[model samples]
Each structure stands twice: as structure tokens, then as C-alpha cells.
Target: MTSRNRSTRVSILSALIGATLAVPAAFAGQVDTAGIQSDGSYARLVVKYRDSARLRTAAADRVAETIAGAAARAGIAGGVARGGAALPLSASRLRATASQADVVRLSRALDANQTQALLRQIAADPSVEFVQVDRRLTHTRLPDVRPMLVPNDNYYQQYQWHLHDAIGGIGAESAWETSTGEGVVVAVLDTGITAHPDMDANMLEGYDFITDAFVSRRDSDERVPGAADLGDWNPVANECYAGSPVTDSSWHGTHTAGTVAELTDNATGMAGVAHDAKVLPVRVLGRCGGYTSDIADAIVWASGGEVDGVPTNASPAEVINMSLGGGGACDTLTQDAINGAVSRGTVVVVAAGNQGQDAANHSPASCANVINVGATGITGIKAYYSNYGNLVDLSAPGGGVTDGNPDGYVWQAINSGATVPEDPTYGGMAGTSMAAPHVAGIVALIQSAVEVPKTPAEIEAILKESARAFASAPSQPMGAGIVDAPAALALALDGGGEEPCEPGEPGCEEEPPIDSTPITSGQVVTGLSGVAGTEGLYRIEVPAGMRNLNVLTYGGTGDVSVYVSRGSEPGADEHDWASTRPGTNETVRVANPEAGVYYVKVVGESLYARVNLQARYN
Candidate 1:
């Protein structure tokens, strides 16, 4: 399709917000959590009331009373909105119409040790719906210092090996055949982007959440218009902070933005992972990093929430790309905001911290419900500096600058100058930061597929399930393997699996005598037994390292049999595991099974039995 034709289709679909936000029903009541400081105190607490509508409709007196009641219930003598005190409305510079009167500020008199108790008391009160600790986060990328060859697009292909390299790349070419992320909006929250020839047209007006004038390096105290990169250089004469050394601006956000949706086929610069997708360039980082409060507000606003003190975002993102982070754990503040974004249908892709240690120690990455990405080098091994352990959900090419070759670095658009008159140029950087945008770009492609919008959980499942297995496992496990954009897209569009099979001994009239549905872990399939003595058959493709496979049947008055078989066909010797007995629930769990397709049989012992079968693999 031509550009003009595709543009119209995108406009029509733009209204389909959070088209893919599928999360487990069990997590609904829990507050999104993140890292905790050792000081026994999270800098802040995000208190959400039982009703969101109250923020907009409640009168001043009522709002004030609600705040007072919550604080008093928590036994806070000072550290909160006191009764009859002038209300301190939670506000952000960008959200002009937002009402933060619902958020009660903790009093300064309270010590960090007193927080947990007060928080518990506040939480026990029925008035509070959700609360999270305000944790700190820093940019996940570190420092480094790319052109090369490719097919068609005469741009910076040689330097962008991470985009097409067979060793560790996502195979951008094949994935582009299906989608260019035409209608998707990917929000980048970082130091911000500068004017770059390759990415200007793809940019959206974003807010500056860095409220400190010194850190913002701007004349104003609050947020302003376009998301421009005002050099982050901390000169020697004016150190960014006490004991901080002067350094050059990284233009970190600009580089990540370039990787996600920089203009492609235009042939002026490198092709982006999702060329046609729009970028919502959010500025959340600045000199000496940024505050967690500012970052949290950006996450809320980016997901289309009414963040107090800031205007509602005109273009809410379907995928939020956060390449920046600090260490600790998943802080409650960041986690809660992330949950809000995910709840609104946004797929958040975060960089595993650059620290070469267990990723479980990192925030957001370890937080619930987000896709945490690790970095791999051109050799397809975990990058030396990339975080490892179970927390990493997947891995991507973040470049290996020290692999004895400059070619290993992922290259993209940036400004060479340290501070002002932006000079559009290209360079290479190596970190988990570079890996995240790759996933974000692919997420845009997945979201823009003709198939239905996928929830964050579904999207993660697809990306992990479809990843190309590494030739050999890394020293540390890095998810299922490197992300395979083409494979992930194909699986995503397939819509989980084929329809379920009808009840019968053979289940079908075919020669195989079985019709199976494609199944991923955590998927539940329901079917009717039709009549007594008949059975419902299903097939599951269990990936490698899947240590547990459990099949359970629930509901129906009649007796039902549940069994797991080793092959595609259910036979006499095929039963590797079985749970037989009459009752409402029957379960069979296999601790170890050969990596291959497994068949599940649900037998009905009575007339018209309604059975719900679910398969779980981990």
C-alpha cells in the first residue's frame, strides 16, 4: 500500500486505545510495586481512592475531608494532609487541568522508619484503593562510542548491525513485510530528543516533566512544548550537583527514539525498527538524572490518565519505551504508575539495568506486569554489562562495543555537539538501553497488526514464545532467547491458537483421530463433552525448559477424566500423566516432560458435561 492510503487507515484505527492490554484477573486489586530504598522509606506513596470519578466531581470540602480522613486513619500526626489545612494538590507542570487533590502529601516530620506502619494503616482503611512506594530510577544505559552495508535503503545500514545482523539481530527486513507500525504511538521517556533530520516528521509534541530549573537548564520551572533535547552537559564551572563531574550530553532519548521510529525508505539516515510509527518524545531525564515523581507523572500522562497539574496527553501511547532507570527494586511509585499505564492498555518495555549483575535487583524490570529486556552482543551471547537472572523476560541486540570491533555497536541519529545548535549525526552505543527500543519497535509492529490489539501479558507471551532460540544458551539465561520480530509478528497475528475441538473419542474424522489447538502457557480452553463416555482432546506445544505442565478440569455435575499424554495422539501408552477420579476438579501435573507436543484428554462420564480445561506450563 502507498503512504497516502496507509495514512487514512491509521487515522481510523488511532481511536482504538489500549487495543492489546490483556492482564490476569487476579492482579486487579494489587498495587503495582517496585524497588525499596534500604532506608525503610520510599520517597513517596501513591494513594489511589476507591473511586477515580471523585477526583473530577467532588467538591473542595469533600475532597479535603477525604484527605484528612485518610491521613488520620493512618495515625499520621503531621506527615500528611492535616484537617482544615490548606490542601497541597498533587500537581505536575505539564498537566494543566489535572486535579491532584486526591493525593494526600506525607508530612515531613515523619521519619522513614514510620512509613511502613503508616502505609499499612492507610491501606487497611476501606477509603484507599491502591498505594505504591515512590522509588527512584535512573537511566539504564551507560557510555560508548557506527556505517555499514545492506539491501535497498541507502542509509546507515552498515553501522546498524543490531537491526539486521544474523548473529543477534531481529531480522527487521522480514518483519517489515507485514507491518511498519503505521498507526502506533511509542512514548519515549528519557533525557529527550533533539532535532534530527531522520526523525523530525515522526515526532509528536511531548511535555518536559523535569521541573527543576537547574536540571532542566531552561528558563521556566515547569513543562513546556515540544520534546527537544537541550544539551545535558554538566560543565566544570557549573557542576550538575555537589561532587558530580562534568560530562557531555548523551542525547540518550534521541538515540532510542531513532531506533524505534526514525524515518525509513527516505534514504537520508538509518531505517528504524518501526519506521511508520509515531513517537511521543517524553523528557523525563536531565543533568544528574531526574526525580521519580517526575517520571511517574509522565507514565500516568503518557497512558492518557488525568495527571494533576498537567494537560491530558493529546496522543496517548500504546507502547511506553522507558530506556532509563536507576537501581533499587521496583519502587511503588514507579510500579503504580506503570500499572496505571498497563491497565490503560499500554505495553511497557523497560531496559534491564546496565549493571552486570542479577537483573532481579533492578526496578521496573523486576516489577510485575512489564516486559524486561536484556542485551545480547553480535555473538548472540548476553552482553557483558547486561543484567541477568530470571527477571529478564527476553533479550535483544544492545551491541557489544568491546567485541574487538566497532561494528558491534548499534548506531543511530544524534547530535555531535555537547550543548547547542544541534548537529544531526550518527554514533554507536552499547547497553540494555539500546536493546529495549528494538522490542518497543517490534511491539509497535505487533500492536499495528491486522489482528486484535494484544494486552501487555499477551504481547509478552508472544514475544517470549516466538523468540529464536540461541544456537547455545548464554552463560546466564536471557529469556527464551533473542526477540524474533518476524516470528513474533506471525504468531501474534495468528491470535493465540485455532478454535477448540468438538467432543468425541477421536475428536475428529481425520486419519490422526485428533484435532489440537495451539497453546501457550497460562492459556485456558473450555469445551463441552457433549455426552457421557465422550472426550475433548487438545494439543499443546511446550517450549524447552518448561519444567511443569499441569492440566485441570473444573465444573459440570458428571464425572470427567483428565490425563496428559506425551505425543500428538492419545493412546494406551501415550499417557505420561493422569488424574482420574470423579469430582468437580481433576488435576495432573508433569514435573518433567520431553520438549515437544503433548496431548490432553478430558473424558466425560455423564450426559452433557460442561468442562473447563486449562493448561499451565512454566
Candidate 2:
């Protein structure tokens, strides 16, 4: 491709795929041809048939005979057919990748009437349940025009104040050295990623966990075998009658993956935050919305599978990116499954949701172990659609429709073949979904930069503390602040000053202690204290109207606990320890008590504690 063309392709892919954090898995040979539309020239066929309980011997011979007869009568260059238990019928499609001239010749040869007759004959065959012209590819094109890399001057000035004089300029090279994310795998749980030129080189093994085969194959049968290296594009299966069959729409995963690590500075397309990181495409959402159960299973499998009879994923992912969420109370089962993954060293990142409502209005995003992300515009202003709350860990560039900012929106391409609007370079879009991957990609970069591997908690801390704070931030609900890739990577390599804390020991004199005086009804008293010899521990009285209470601390190597009692005294302590070493805060919920004084204590075995207390009223 020419430089200009390559640039356009890169820009388009970058905007669509963006950064992701997860592992790729070996591709399963499942042929999913969901997007193929019926056109006059050719018809895509889905054949359904019953497989007998007998061995493959009978079916194999029958399919072989049929193939030989078909090949003898007509000119067939290449095609695939196989027999397997999962396959419903002996199915194969006659396809040709021809140029425009070749297409014209082929169309004339088949003729309109001849083509109709051929389709009828094929459909009439008992083995073939369906046959229709494949037309989805006809309209495919490189996007016609480039997207606005930076918003128009008017949009930038009037509404996009966040990007105005932001620290990083467009294409501003980071002083921090580039690092390799080659081995780390990021699993993107979203709408499927369309195959694009920019992603071909860096894309790794991935499977469609949404399918019945529990593999990445999109087709239900192994009747046809194709290339091994290519990933499967399975649409989510329809569970309800009202739900449409799975089809690729927004190309959400592709965009997120490109951002996380899109073969940066390869003299072709846009640079990714961690260009070397490998992306694992895990399809979760399809037509309308994905199910909570499927999402839960995807999480388990992505983080190394085998959660309650769901097959153990063939490949384990180090990080999983979930850019989808639904409204509901956080499910305990889901939370436990996530925690199980975290305990296994898989970092889970979730979108805070795009509703612009409180995060408590959502689920998995509201789960404790996951890193909940909110959205900021190109100019650094919070996107109108970004969901926020104390649950949000940080924010990143999630493009906005109304306001425009350099940082407020990402400039990248949409999948031209998918239903989403296709733009060459940049299109304005917004969501916590866009913001979550920014952090996931940053995590990949940090993992690449650091010598000693950081735990998920430590990685989260570096990102949160190193974020760029917006001067006019709307609320603390936005979390620490917008993500800063360079700053976060720098902190990661520098170790972020993490150390062990001990009980009753004079806390880090340098680090501020968590001190609270007023300690009101619904407010938490928070501070960081050093643990000297033993783990750090602290106690406070839970005031009235405080229905729940918990503690948060950093720089400890052991378990932590939160104790609560109706009276101003310690009861049986509820120990909620960190699952990993070099841990960050631990929270415990306490039931509301009668109007009277109550005690809340935080203790860490063998370390000092930097504590942040939080309380919610009944």
C-alpha cells in the first residue's frame, strides 16, 4: 500500500481496534458466515443435516463420493469439506477471490438464469438446508474520506476545552523508551473484530468462546477446514426469539485491540500505546446485548477457563478487557468468578458503562476486583455519556458526540465492512467502553517496561496515582483522573515506592497517615501509613447512618481485615485479605447499627497500612 493509503488504513484500524489487554488462543476451525448477504452473483449457503451415531466411516465415504462426482462435472479450483461428529451435514461453499475483471467474467459465465437454477438445485439437495448469494463483501471499500484527526477548530475551541493545551500533543513522542508486549495476551470481550490490514501482522490466536464448540470457530460444524492461523469470526448466538442472530456490528473489539497494540510505528498506520502486545479476540456481545452468564463464562475461560464445567480454555490470558456492561446489582457469583481469575494473576478491566449515571447502576463494573474505567473527551473533559462513581478507578479518551476535544475523542477508523459508520482517520464516538481499553493498553506497556512483574493491584495503583488530574473535574466520581501513559509507565518502571507495612509500627513518616476527625455519618476517613515490623492496623468508631464500612491500604505483603461492631468495641474481625502480594486497599461491608457509637478497625498482618475508609447508608 502507498504511504497515504497505508496511513488511512492505519488511522482507520487504530480508531476501531485501539489497545486491549488479554491473551490469544489457538483458532478453532468453525466457519461462521453470518454477514454474507444474498446477491445475484453468488449465494452463501448454510446446510443443515443430521449426523448418525455411527462412526465417521460411513459419512466420510459418502462425502468423498459426492465431492468426486461434483468435481468431475464442473471446473472447481479449490474448496473444503470434512466429516466430524459436530457437523450437521457435509457442507462446503464454492468461492473465488477474483479481481473486478474476473468477477465480470464469472458473472457472465454463470448468467442470471443459470445462477438461479444453480441455487435452486443446491437448495433442493436434501443435505443443503439453505443457499443464498453471498453479497456482504460487494460494498467493501477503504473508507472514502479521512476522519478528523483533531476536531475542527470551531468544535475544538467552543466545546473541547479538555484538549486545549493538554500536556500531550497529537503524535507527541514519549521520552520514555518503548517496551515489548510481545508475549502478553489481551482478551477483548466485545463485538467481533473485523480482519484489517493493520491487525493481520500482530493478531494472535483467539477463539469465539460464545460458540457451542467452546472454540474460536464461528461455524457450528467442522465440516470444512480452512487455514489454521486465521482467527474465527463467530457472532454471538441468539438465545431469545426476539433476539437477532449474531452479526458483526460496531467492530468494538477490533478498535479496542488496535488501540492496545496496533503494530505501532511500523511505517504504516497509527502507533498503539503498546505496539507489541498481542490481542486475543474473545467474542461476547453480538446483536443486542450479551448474556451475564456468557460474559461470566468468557471471563473464566479468558483467565484460563474451567469454571464449573465450562471447559478450561486452551490458552490462558494475562489480562482480560471487558468493554460491556448492563444495569443491575453486582452478582456475587460473577464477582467470585472474577476474584478467582484475579487470584490467578489475570487483571480484569471493565468499562464503567456509557449511561452517564452512577456506576452503582451497573454490575461487573461495580464488582470489586475489576478496574472500572470512566470516559474523558479528547480535551480531557468527562464525556457526557461516561458513567462515573467512587467505583471508577480512572478515566481515558472516550470520544464524545456533542463536545469535541483532542483527548476527549480518539481519532481512528471504523470497520468499513461492519454496520458502524466508516471514517478514514477519525470519527467522534464516546463511551466508558472506549476509555477502558486505554488503561488496558497502558497496563500492557507497563508490563513490558517493568523488570519485576507487578501484581494487578500494583499495576492499578501506578495507573491511578500517575493519572493527569483535570483542574475542573466534575467529581471525585471520575476516580484518580484521566490516564497518562508515559507517567504510568514511568511509575511502573520506578516501582511506585511500594513497601511492606507492619502492625502498630510507626507508619511511613514520609507517607501521610490516614486521619479523620469529624468522621460524619456517610463519609470515610482515609490516609496512608507505613507498617514497621508487623502488619499495620487501625481502629475507628463507625458513626450513625453509616450502613456499610471498609478500608483501603497499599504497600503491604500480607492479608488485611476490617472489623465492625454495634458498640465502640471490636467484635469478631472479618478478615478480607489481598489475594496477591504488593497489594492495594481491601474493603469489607458492615451492617448498619442502631443510632449509637460503633467501632471500625482495619488490620493488616505483618505490614503498615495506608487506609481509606468508605461508608454507605442503608
Candidate 3:
């Protein structure tokens, strides 16, 4: 994929009136004494009343009361309380006033021992659901350097360049065939983006759902009302702290957004796969790990806002990209919200996770409604750190841990200044996080090339059928196979065309009995000793009401595979199903098998070995 370069320029537009408002910093006298650090700067307090039945009516009141009582006892100056569903109780950031005593007294009063007592006292209240120290945020670091790209390497190029080649390149000659991702608005739910050269022209309207302060600025900016800044909220900076500190890691969000829809062919930094598609930036993560409740709100808002406080999202996104995950089971509330997004015609795409375990243990990605994407190396093999499972829908190049080749992975960085580099600049990184955007880009390309809008089910079907299966991939690791852009686009454009089988159809006919043996339930169908391979070929007939059909091989050393089609003569290399493995018994299930006599071919695994077959339905 060739990279594009555009001149860098920065534009500071007039701020919208209501867009620049600052949140009030009044502490309702709540002092969160649980898990206060020795430094007296940070404390871990479990949020109170996260899911109270009367939360809608008295949430603010309950939070205010808790803060007031804690402040009075601890002699804390003031503090801030934020709502979070993931925690059972409200957490506060408190400061000890001068009258309260010196730093030593404050520390002694709110130390671990005191904190435990405070928790016990708070638990006596029936309204308080639970309380515990807020856990500190942690992250696994990625190597900080650009990976080297091999010479003339086409495979490692950016997604857009490959897409351009698939559509016959950049001039008017290819105008009619050019792909534009219509009806596909991708939601970049991450840290806020910096107005970089490549992204300034492509980004759509987005909001900071993280800091309630509503000020849009960089991380280093002082805590002033109505000030815009970049970076995560730092709770230690202010007494009534509601945010975390910003760090270099915060740039991840901007970089990811650029890869999905950076302005293309404009001689800019780099071309994104679907340059014309809109991006909905939903800020969720900040300095420390964001609260689950905030991330949940971002999801709902990105999907068109089913919850209150979030204004009704104007342009409901068609795709949501969550590059973050936590160690936990799929939560009911979170999963329900994802399902709600899908029901509203949105396709949620999530990282398979960087944990290198089966994704079933994680939330959202493991959730049934979204598409879980795993990471692949430049050589088209699975990335060492990528998680895998039957739940994984597909795989894409996510740049290897130590094998950066062909310009590494050069994507736009979030919060990068106006002077960001242009050309095929490389930055090496590995994780399922990088793999997801590739799939999102492919989905955009497929949508752009096809006329009819495909449902999530149809899109998934097309992707699975067009995937390039590999024998070297681990059984549960790589999924159906690596993603093929050209193949996927071709399938999308074909409207997933169908073929038929039966008497009168092109390659249809009746078949003679095999090996002079009569068919029986327990007997395995063996080699073609009696029947002619060409003249005696017959298709298995499927009846109605059957949702699934399976073709099995009882015993064989040769390859055995199944194909389902409406057409008797299948198109070149377009079999509905194909497998190359030999086993004592192998079963291939066909979903919603159609009512037709579909050809089931059994080929030899090795030229000299014989294969046997059997069929079952459910």
C-alpha cells in the first residue's frame, strides 16, 4: 500500500458556545478515606450505591450525604464524587484542611487502618451497596520504536493502498469503480484526538465523555474552568479530583483513529483505508484506567445514546472499535448495551485482546453480538500475543513483536501536533488492538464496493466464506483464516451469488450404488470402485425444517471436505465449504442448510489413500 503525503497545516476554528463550558468543582463534603495512599495524594474508595433501585431519584443525594459525613469526621478540606456503575459505592478525592491538622495527623487519620474502620462504618448504612479501595491502573508496555519494512514489500503496505490497487488505482479511469464507505460511521472510543495533519480534514464531530469538566485541552494544562486540554485526568492534581494524569500512552487513541479514516491521497502523512468514511470519537479512557461506568456510557453514546446525561448522538455509528479490555467475565449491563447497538444496525468490532488466551474469558469481545478480531503477523501467521477462540471472527496484520517489515505500521497518532511526519513513516507495535482496525477498514471497503447494505449476519458470512484458511494455523488460534481484501470485496460485489443442484441442473444426475454395497445407517460410504466418478456423481438431498447439516468421514487417510451450493456446477474455487484434514472421524456442520441436493465432494488427503463419507442432520 503506497503512502500519501499532504502539506501540514493547523486550523483553530471558533469554539461553539455551549461546547466550551467548564464543570463546577464544588465538593459536597465527601471524604473518601478507604485505601488512601501513604503519600496522601491518592486513595482507593469503592463507589457507593452504583446500582441502587432508587439511583435515578436519590443518587446525587446519597453521594452528597456520604461525602458530608466523611469530610466532617476526617476534617478533609473538600472532595469530588463521580458516578460509576462498575463500583458498588461512590469514590471521592479529598484534601485535609489546615484546621484539620498537619499532614502527619491527616495521614494517621485516613491511613489503611482508619480507612478500614471507615468502610465498616459506611457498610452499616442500608443504602450503601458495597465499599472497597479503588484499584490502581496498570498496563503492559509496548516497545518504543518503528519496525523496519522490507524492500518492495507489497504485503506489508497500508490497507488503503491495497484497496486502491484492488479497485484499479487513483485516476478518473477508476472513478466509477472507486470504493466509498457509505452508511458506515466508525466510532473511535478512546482518548481525545490531536488535530494532526492527516486527521484534521477527515474527523467528524466527537465529544469527551471522560472528564465531566467539559474543558477540551491537552494533559499538561492546569485545572482551570472551561480550558481545553489533551491527556488523561490526574486525580492527584486537585483535591476534588475526578480525572487521571495524562501520559504518552494517551496518544494511542489518536493514532488508532487515523488508521481508520485519515484523509487519503492528499499528499498527507498516510492514507487510511476508508478516507471518506466518518469517524465518531467517543473519549472513554484517560490518565488512569477509566471507570467501567464511563466506558459503558461511551458505548451507549456511540450507538446513539440510550442513557441519560449523554445527548442523543446525531450520527449513529455503524461500527464501534473498542481497543481496550479488562480481566473479567462479560457483564450483563455491558453486553446488553452492545446488543442494543447491534439491534440499531451497528456492527461492533473489538480487539480479541492482548492476553494471548482464549477470548472467552474477556468481556465485550467475548460477547456474542460483536466481531472479535485476532492479530496476524506480516507473514500471515498468528501474532504470538493475540488471543484466540471459536469466538474470534477473523484475523488481520497487527505488526509483529520483533518482526517489523515493509515500513512497520505507520498510522496517525492521536494528540500528535500539526507537524506530524508524512510518507511511509513506521512505528512498531503489536496487539489485537492493531488488528481490529484492519478488519474495520475491510468492512468499510466491502460496504463501499457493494450496492446493497449487508446486515451483520451477511457481512460475517461473506467474511468467513472468503477467508484464506491455512493448515499451519493452530486449531483454535487463527480462526477461519487471515483476511483477504480482494476476495472480500469480490464477494461483497457479487452479492454472495448462489448456485443450484438436482436433476436438470447443469452437473446434476442420479448415481449408482457404491462398491455393490447397499446403503445402511451404520455402514460408512467408501471409495468409487463400482460407480464412475463422472457419470455416477449424485448430490445429497436436504429436506425442510432442518437448520443444520453435517458431513462426516468415518475413517480415512485421505482428505475429505463438504460443499453446499444451489448450483450443480460450482464456480471456480468458490466452494461453500472446503477442508484438507484427515481424521478417524471428521464432522463439518452447515448452518441453515438449504432445501436442495447439494454436492458433497470427498477428495483424497494423499493421492494414494482412500476416503469414506457419512451424512447427518440436526
RMSD (Å) per prediction: 12.0, 18.1, 13.5
Q: Compose the digit string of candidate 3's lDDT tens values, residues 427-526.
A: 3455667667767766776666677666665666666666665424554645657666667677777776233246677777755432222233234576
Q: What is the TM-score of each candidate against the true structure?
A: 0.67, 0.52, 0.61
* lDDT of prediction 2: 0.49
Which residue ranges in model 2 land beyond 4 Å of their true spot? 1-172, 175-180, 212-248, 307-315, 401-408, 418-428, 497-618
Of 1 and 3, the candidate ranking higher by TM-score: 1
Worst lDDT run of 10 residues, candidate 3, spans: 1-10
lDDT of each residue in 255-348, candidate 1, tens digit only: 8999999888886768899999999999988776776677878888888987766778999999999887765566555666888899999999
Answer with 1 or 2, whichever has the higher TM-score: 1
Report the C-alpha lDDT of model 2 over 1-618, residue by residue, as the tens digit: 000000000000000111111222121111112221132333222222223312544443443333334323333323333643232122232211111000011212233344444434433334432322222110001112113443222232332232223631211236226555656777777655665555657666565434223232345522112112122223555421224355444555666776666655554445455567777776655444443444565677678856433445665777888877755445433555687778878888888887778876566667777888887665566777778876777777766633324434554433544444343232334566766776787777777667776777677767776777654556536776777777777777777725434446786344333332324445655554445333333444443444444334434344444444432344233321222223445544433233433345544544554455554445
Candidate 3 Cα misplacement greater than 4 A, ranges: 1-177, 211-229, 232-247, 401-410, 414-428, 469-475, 497-550, 553-618
lDDT of each: 0.70, 0.49, 0.51
Angstrom error of the Cα, residue 131, model 2: value is 41
Arrange candidates by lDDT, descending. Answer: 1, 3, 2
